[model samples]
Target: MVRAGARFMATGPAQSFLRRYGWRIDRALIKATKGHLSMSMVMPEVLLTHTGAKSGQQRSTPLTYFTDGGRVIVVASNYGGVRHPAWYHNVKANPRVTLTSRGYRGTFLGEEVLGDERDRLFELATQFMPNYAGYQKTTQGRRIPVVAFTEVR
Candidate 1:
């Protein structure tokens, strides 16, 4: 079902719809289910709360995530768009964040991985969601960012 959804999401119109209002729907469903349900019903989904980069206001975004080596990984693919998502910029400016995923909720420090680490994580991300590779191809040379979020002790 998620694969089919991903394929649909790849369409120009679907992308536009998702870019506009998908997050709201995801948030509503998550809230209604108390975080037990996500739009991507199979893969782990996260609700990340971050401080806006420019506005310095609190913002939240729902994202697909996967656990690897005790770290939670999320791809800032922006659905293959040319620019990084707004959340990515916020996270870059303020690495501290709050996350709720897989029934766990806590503070985490988000770090954008680079070099071999990034390559490895991105590969793992692709395995978790194959559409990501296709998203990369559409990125024109913007090398999508992969972030690792670790619980703050």
Candidate 2:
């Protein structure tokens, strides 16, 4: 049932609604629980904080993430939407980021991965949540970005 619902939520109005409100609820839960929870019924989630590109304001986004060799990976699929997520652009403008995950918080430098690296990370992300495949399908010609966040000293 969860898988079926996940497929349904991967596109159309269901996804739009969830995209509008789901992250807000997840962020609240993370704040309340101190990162014990954010993404349930799915892969690991992180609360990523970054400086806005234009506003220079701090922004926080809850995202499902995977890890490779201690580096955090996140996708900019934006539910297969044509436009990228705001956080993606933020990280691009300023790679330094602060993230909270699994009850722990740390700082990192975000970088967009491409070529073979993106393909590999995308595979891992898809395995974590099959819905990402649907996201890629919906985005058409646009290439969804794969970002890696390595810890900052």
Q: What local lDDT does model 1 show for residue 150? A: 91
Steric clash count of candidate 2: 0
| Candidate 2: pairs in clash | none
lDDT of 1 by residue, 9-83 (tens): 678888788788988898777766767887776667899889999999998899998888888899999989899
Error of 2 at 89 (Å): 0.6
Kindly report which residue stretches of model 1 are placed more than 4 angstroms away from their true locations once superposed: 1-5
Best by lDDT: 1
Clashing pairs in 1: none
